[model samples]
Target: MSYPESLERYAALGVDTEQALQTLAKTPISLHCWQGDDVNGFEGSTGDSGGIAATGNYPGRARTPEELRSDMNKAGSLIPGAKRLNLHAIYADAPEIPDRTELTSEHFRPWIEWAKEQQFGLDFNPTCFGHPMAESGFTLSSADSRIRQYWIDHCIACRKIAADIGEELRNPVVTNIWIPDGYKDVPVDRAAPRQRLEESLDTVLAADVSKEWNIDAVESKLFGIGVESYTVGSHEFYLGYAVKNQICLCLDAGHFHPTESIAEKISSALQFVPSLLTHVSRGVRWDSDHVVLLDDPTKAIFEEIVRCDALDRTHIGLDFFDASINRIAAWVIGTRASQKSLLLALLEPTDELRKLEAEGDYTGRLALLEATKSLPWSEVWNEHCRRSGVPLDTDWMKDVRTYEKEVLSGRV
Candidate 1:
């Protein structure tokens, strides 16, 4: 259908197509770099002892930073709208021997420089697992003080690195902390570990990083692989911490109960937290980071955010790494799915729907919502892609296959 024809359909529903398209254009989706390399950064370590792991041996996984960047570039071109790149501390380009604890921003200079070239804002994370110290299945909340101190230093260093990047880029870099601290069986003493965690976090956040450059965020997981009985950084713990510490809460959609709806959690979180950083992912049965889809959950989350008028307040980032498929294709699919959901939300006649609810017209509200399902949203999405100078169809995947043949196949 023509753009004008689609616009008229949406207009009939009291939705402004032009305004929706513009809103979708500027909304930034933070694309994760881990998807290109299956969370294996340059460290060349397989000690991701705890936490969720990307489960696939997909060929053409980018081994070097250069390859990763090229792959990200390919995926970024196909993605519509603004984007920011999220990095883990493991992705650091250390000039010398790898040191997880004594890391600095200098170790990630190459990343900052390249991100600058790409005109992409950078976000960062502290790798609290996947090292000798973290192999004990704990970090900040480790029973051993020395081991706990190591993770603390690492987390503190990450904040500084994030601050430097943000200072140079002149945009706040979100430094998120997600520790895989839990047990396979029931824990005899849960409160003690949580107390230790509270103390360790205090030391980490005590560093006087400028808020202008750094936004501190703590991610809570319901549970990870073996850490089933208890997660030290549960949602309740981080929610309270985020409120008291005045930091951003990083919510991963897949971290909650499968039956739970994270879309419904947006407004509640915004009320307490200063800002929010969300990691959008899809989980099949558990917290398996499958590639995000344009499913009901994904669409509902974006719709809720739009309805809450928290688009600017919430930072949306993709966190799934589906190594089972073409890495670049996975990136494009997941990121595009998110963009499509945002576009759908923006295209909704939210104001009219709200008016319906306010006037106690419940039936009209459901009717208008049901009617929106048939509107030509694809036309607006295609138009957005055309304006962004990206592919409007499956043409982008051809580039990925070409890259796989020319660049990736030769990796071994």
Candidate 2:
């Protein structure tokens, strides 16, 4: 682990090292479960398999619920600090929920029990694609009334399940609704589909579940494999709906233009929306759902959250699936990057920077910002991993290699 000299260097800037560690320990990042199985849920699904396409097929993907959970256990051990599990409706490992429309809380009992053992907070998302119903490249916004109602029922049912799970765990579940609804060609009437989506959302959210147990959020998309021309749940639509309904709006990092600043949107949304749900993802050209890295955007995001004092109102979660590499490593890297970003943000001398800005001393603000880039951040991170009882170096890769050889390789 790093020495005490690194801590002293951070203190010279008026930042408290011990307090930053404690704050990082309490910040819970939701680890996405889809990475374990390449988004191939055990629902026996078909049809338009959503627009979410996980590329590359490295050997040894988890094939069962027990296997996936075991893999998560290994990844969780290496990723320190508080952690949560973000699940999809399709991941339910029960015989009862034979179809998406008939899903119930009972179907997720196994998951709830597993979460209890892992001591993880929970979050959920409704499966709006990968079924015969969504083949038309639309779900809730489909012109067909029957198609729209089926998805609406599924979404409403998912919220109930989320509420029950959150009630059991005593941690509110952020139930997000995202649909692959759009058209490939310029629509003769664009307003009709969005209008239909509006009514369906109103019906789905009609449930009176306690906000303490379940917080609802709506996710929007830019474009997908099939829906290249338009997406029904665009940012404008969901932003308006979330504000009007007094709910949270989910800002997925990959769900916008490549150059768009997701970090900048946090303060903008918090000004009107009750809360925010961030799906921390990295996009190259489109929503490829690449494994998240400690890039500039990721760093800027948490810094902005801290600067605006919106930690309590913000929910941080991972959203990526890359089948080409080791799945366990993907989880550990992304979750750790998020934790590291938060730690870096907490260690910032924000008061001094803001004080400079308030006095219109732009030179001082920029100078301090540049100097912060060379601080002893890695030393603090090394100590954090040491105290969290996780590996502080490349030792984690050895664990994944052993699991791949002894456990994952055994799967047929």
Candidate 3:
């Protein structure tokens, strides 16, 4: 799984060699089923298949254990040849009545058992009960021992469940922790949250050091909503904090401002974190999570893929949630588009490009774009399909065009 020499040279220039190479060697993209309502038979939000509802209640009820198992089996059957499948949790908050809290283990037990039976890895998020604290902007003020203890207990429970599943299946399982604990009005004592977060992470990490579990601190950026902004600076702050304690970073593409360069941001983040995981989605004025073409002519995503390929960092995760198409289809299309973009980037003539970059030849580098302008995207798609051993169909170009149209219309 060694990278090419060109990438090694790029690494010598202070680009993350190992992280980049590891990313290039693998495309462990996982499909998230967070918006299950987009699929048929499930309830949905009004005006959109899975958008936020006026009432906090999303339009769907939880599927029973038997039904969940059946759905997993069906989803598995639909994509039998997929290289891997990662299951996300069903709820963000403790649902009304909390049906089967003790059976939380039982609910996931079938899916875990099924992945083992079918041989695919599983990734999940730790259950943090106090998500409202981020919006309420009072995490620091509460200082309530009970609230603090609740957070501690939730982390322990999440780790215990992850360990139990990992031990049962003997596979690498990821526990992603996306914090919603920042302030909304004034600058709070950053040290307290950082200390609590690190303490909670240390507690989880210490429980089973031998288990193949990773804790990814997912940094999200929000606009016009909070005093403590969720910007790239915040992400950098956490990565530096995590490095002090040996943790991982999950980079979300949609979490950046529309003006930011995702490639440069990713490159900068990689300088600190050894491994990278990102959510792929488009945004307009801010972080909107719109699903756009990975190779959109805007060139933001294309350039990022090129840098990632040149640096050999390819550990990408597809995070797409749109209400129009089938949720499963959105994931499949997004994954395919991302792979197409990466393969095209790999085909780039790096030696010439690097020379132009050194000489401050922005126009010369831009020529690479014109040269690739006539890149028969169909050929790229076909090549990707062939390399990945996936089936190709005539409808792919149509799908790409439809996706492009959605990007233009800002529906995705």
Candidate 4:
């Protein structure tokens, strides 16, 4: 589908407006703000984190549905144009095996109803069983049947929930599965775990398809388990499995190794699947869900956006966890920056660049960079906010200029 003419008007002002809008349209950005009470010692805590308790026992025991709706509405108002919201929580209290049968449409009905009323979509992620279960390390092929059953049941519940919601709303519910199940140390039978994982996924997808719901398998890099190498096996295994089973790959930008190029990775991943959904975070050492920013050129966040734009992906969810600044401000800034970077990337003539690559010309990339050098960030931001009907914030232009300078200097 072609971009709207309004986007073309922005492109005339020297922004890759058409590409930016297209990239943003493909991915409905959502933030992952699910920290359940254990903030101080949460394993994934980073500079960006925010949440209010969803459950507790005290004088004010339960939060009313109105309270929940208010919180969601507030988040929606903050973003102004966001179309989806992701909720993540760890099922900590259930020590016994999780009962998938207990999970019903009724359980999530209230939240789903609220989301529909508010005109936003819902997605969820359950913490890996290994995070709380393993004292040393947990493998998918672990001898502990309880852990395996826990994960299996969780997936089953998620699929059921997605199917139920889809039936209720008459549209597909996006269910994402990200397992921390990986090898910690060298073991006898690596292939067995891989086989088990494939089988498990196949079963899950089969069950999901039986219910007429869609399932997306998310392959990510692991952290905090003391084992350094967990990348190659998981991705390769999942990609192969997804291809065979017709599953979608959910790509997270922060999960790649430091040495890998984001642009190259996006291009390669898109070859396998037409589009990808990802969580955004900033970290050189660890997977911190920081707001997406071009502060570091080495990360190539901007270039990745450009690559994805050329491919015309389905949706780009701005997955971030924020605790420091006003969450609303963070969302606006992050979304604007992401859109800007994408627009700049689209300005590049891909066909010309391909020809240059075939002839071994580094100058094509440099030429694209130079073309984006004169882009007016302030004007672009102003025009976009006007078009989107969000209040314009001029102060952010300074950082935008700094980002542009860094990009032009090849510092990014």
Candidate 2: which stretches are off by over 4 Å? 1-3
Best-first order by TM-score = 2, 1, 4, 3
**How close is every model to the real structure, measured as TM-score?**
0.97, 0.98, 0.68, 0.71
Q: Please list the residue runs of candidate 1 whose C-alpha ends up more than 4 Å from where it truly belongs after superposition.
A: 46-48
* Residue 240's lDDT in candidate 4: 69
The TM-score between candidate 4 and the true structure equals: 0.71
* Model 1 / residue 180 / CA error / Å: 0.2
- How many steric clashes does model 3 contain? 7
Encode model 2's per-residue lDDT on 1-412: one tens digit a residue.
Answer: 3548878888888898998998899889999999999998888879897677889988878888888999999999899999999999989888555788888878888889989998999899999988999998888998899999999989988999899999999989999999989878777788999999999999999977778899999998888887888888999999999999989999999999999978989999999999999999998887888888898988988999998999999999999999999899999988888888888999899988999999999999999999999998989988899889999766888888898899888887
Candidate 4: misplaced stretches above 4 Å? 1-27, 35-72, 89-101, 130-140, 183-189, 208-213, 226-233, 295-314, 318-332, 346-365, 394-412
Per-residue accuracy of model 4 over 46-151 as CA lDDT, tens digit each: 3211111122221211123343344345445534344665644332122232333345556556667776887666665544432444332543334476766656
Q: What do the candidate models score in CA lDDT, each in turn?
A: 0.89, 0.90, 0.49, 0.51
The model with the greatest lDDT is 2
Q: After TM-score superposition, what is the CA distance of residue 112 in candidate 3 from its true location, in Å?
A: 1.5
Q: lDDT at 78 for candidate 4?
A: 36
lDDT of 1 at 258: 89
lDDT of 1 by residue, 205-312 (tens): 998888899989999999988888899999999999999988999889899998887888889999999888889999787888889999999999999999999988
Question: Where is model 2 poorest over a 10-residue stretch in terms of lDDT?
Answer: 1-10
Model 1, residue 292: distance off in Å is 0.4
RMSD of each: 1.2, 1.2, 8.4, 9.1
